[model samples]
Target: MKTQVAIIGAGPAGLFLGHLLKAEGIDCVVIERQTPDHVLSRIRAGVLEQVTVGLMERLGLDARLKAEGLVEGGFNLADGERLIRIDCQGLTGKTVVVYGQTEITRDLMEAAPSRGLEVIYGVGDVAVHDIESDAPYVTWTKDGSAGRIDARFIIGCDGFHGPSRKAIPASAAREFERVYPFGWLGILADVPPCHDELIYANHERGFALASMRSHTRSRYYIDVPLTEKVEDWSDDRLWDELAIRLGPDAAANMTRGPALEKSIAPLRSYVFEPMRHGSLLLCGDAAHIVPPTGAKGLNLAASDVHYACEALAGWFKRNDADAVAGYSERALARVWKSERFSWSLTKLMHRFPEDGPFERKMQVAELEYIASSVAAQAAIAENYVGLPV
Candidate 1:
């Protein structure tokens, strides 16, 4: 098979890229190693910045999103019993929506067939070849059958553990990473949210977050040691901890329920430089990763896809080679900004084992400053809502 672009992975990044290219009359094919069901089953971030929502709108797949997504004007930061609210809309003239990443993926996936975007799922041993040349290809096997796609460009949206990023020679790239000592133990349940807006609390106990997937589906989390096991805490235990850490106001409205999904996700900040290696361009987790503290993971990926689409469009349609050559520098600028925001929020809201009296005081002082200063609030709101594309 031949195409202008071969996208590896059918997750949001890959799917978004495929749809964007196809919209511009550029032929692209998506390859996936997992079944569609498995891909949608993975739990992920629910917050959506304007950039993400804009992409959905551009693809004309936002009917469900606009109807169901919870529009949040602002969110709160908790210092024990106090809730310091940052008015994102007032400060930045923008707001975010509470929509699950799975829903976005489903919208894109469902719209693909109608829009003539082809995705090959449930393939194995997927690999990229000859990325150093103008002509590159992707190969995979399934059910004892082998398949190949020859393309002018191979996009590695296959994620951190996938084979796409590894295809780039180590000598041509640089990696930066910081693994946090604690992980977020989250619970997803079918119940009303405790609060109208999301809350990030930094209590003496630890860090806790109160969020929602919808009016009836609540998602909450608390930072726990990486060594802790999920089995150690039952549904009741986790709920109890959330109530205590989120403080009295949120606790009063909180409803206890059985866990629909519960697990511990480790936190990390990772970036692989030079997103483009010859004909292979990296997107989403293939190029970068940010902790979920600031809800930048999915939004960051959307921004990457937006840039990737533009670069590819420029290359094929306008016959501009510099756009492809400059893809890395362009994407990295926004990637680093988001990484900083996520890391900063994580530090402000989490109780680290290595942190002592001074660190605790610093967290308190910083939160206090943010609450009192509109300038401080604006800075956060700007990044939270996302920078311009």
Candidate 2:
């Protein structure tokens, strides 16, 4: 097979890239290691920044999102007794929507075949070859049969564990990472949300979040040790802890049913420098990852792909490689900003048992300042609504 661009991974990064490129009259093929059902059913991030919503609107992908998504004007920072509202609409003149990642994948996949795009599923042994040559290729196996695809350029959107990032030479890339001592035990319950907007609570026990997926279903998370396992947590114990951390005041009016899903995600910050090499470019989790504190993971992924699409379009239309050459630097500016915001939010909300008394006191002071000062509130509101794409 041959095409102008061969994109690895069918997740948001790769799928959205293919969609944008096709709209620009660029021919591309997308390859995925998972079936369509798997990609559509996998539960992931749900928050959408205003910039992301505008992008989707321009692409004609907002009909279902607008119908099914819940729009919120702001979020609240609470400490059981005290509540401070950060009005996203008032501060930034923008609002956020709560829509599942799975829904976006479903919409993109449904639109792929109509665009004359090829998506190969259940593939194996995906690899990038001849990166230094003019004709870099992606080779893979489908249904026990091997095949090769040659393209003028290739993109690795296969995520952090895939072969995309590994193909880059270690000497040419600078890797930076930090792992937190705590992780979030997230739960999906078959109950209505307790609050109208997301509540980020800081308590002496730990950090807790009150969020929802829909009117009938809710999502919640509590900070726990990195070593804790989901199996060790029972439904009663989970609700009990949630009640304590989210505050007994709010929990009193809230009702919860059996948990539909539960998982633990470790907190980490990772970035790979120089997200491009020769004919291959990387985007999304393949290039960087931020803690979920600021809800930047999905939004950042969308932003990176938007930049990449513009760069690729310039290269194809004007034969100008300048945009392509500057892709890494351009994406990194936003990536680092997001990293800083996520880290700051995590540090303020989560309790670190390893921290000394001074550090712990400092964290409390920061939280108090954010709640009391309008300037500090505005800073958080701006980043939370999202920085410019």
Candidate 3:
């Protein structure tokens, strides 16, 4: 197969990139290691920043999202007994949409086939070759048969665990990483959300979050040790920890149900400098990953695709590689900013045993300042709701 661009991975980044490029009259192909059903059902991030919502709307994918997604004016930050709400709309003049990542993946997958785009799923032995040559190709096997796809450019939208990043020469890359001692044990329940808005709770025990996926389905997470296993947690134990962390008032609003799913995601901050190399470029999780605290993962991935689309489109139009040339530096600028925000949020909300009494007091003072000061509130509001696209 031959095309203008070959996108590896059918996750949000690759699928969205293909859709955007197709809209711009660019020919492209997308390949994924997982089946369409799996891609559509894989649950991850849900919160959509204002810029992400706008991008989806502009791309004509908002019809279903607007109908099914829950719009929140802002979120609440609670420190045990006290709570403060940061109005996203009031501060940033924008509201966030809470729709599951699965929904967006399903929508994009369903839309792709009709647009004359090809998406090969359940493929194996995927590899990128000839990056230095004019013709970069993706080689893989489908149905026990080997295949080759040649394209003018290849995009490594395959996420963190994907091979795209590994294909790059180590000498050409600079990796920055920080793994936290804690992880989040996230749960999907059949019960309704305890609160109207998302709540971030800071307690002596740990951090707890009350968020929702839909009206009837709620998602919640509690900070746990990185070494802890899901098997070690029973429903009663989970509820007990959640109740303690969420405090008495918030616990009253929460009613536990049969957990639909549960998983532990380690908290970490990582960034790979220069997201592009030769004819192959990386975007989204393939390039960087941020902790879930700031709710920037999905939004940052979308931003990466938007910037990459512009660069690819420019390359097609002017035949100048300037946009592609600067893709790394440009994307890294925003990526680092998001990294800082996510890190800051994680530090503020999670308890650390390493902290002294003074440090613990400082954390309380910071929370108090954010709750009492308009300026501090606005800063958190802007980061939480989103920055301009």
The sequence of per-residue lDDT tens digits that candidate 2 reaches over residues 1-389 is 99999999999888889989998999899999999888877778889997678768877888999999999889988865777889889888888999888888888889888877688889999999988778999999998899889999899999989998899889889999999998899999889999889988888889999888888889899999988999999888888898888887779867878988998989899999988899989999999999988789889889989888989999999898898999999999999999999998888888888878898889778778877888888899899989997
Candidate 1: residue 97 Cα off by (Å): 0.6
What is residue 211's positional error in candidate 1, in angstroms? 0.4
Q: What is the Cα-based TM-score of model 2?
A: 0.98
Candidate 1 residue pairs in backbone clash = none
Task: Compute the lDDT for candidate 3.
Answer: 0.89
Q: For each candidate, how many residue pairs have backbone atoms clashing (under 3 Å)?
A: 0, 0, 0
Native-referenced Cα lDDT, model 1? 0.95
lDDT leader: 1
lDDT for each candidate structure? 0.95, 0.88, 0.89
Compose the digit string of candidate 3's lDDT tens values, residues 67-184. Answer: 9999999998889887789987898787888998888888888888887778889999999998878898999999989988999999999999998888889999999998888899
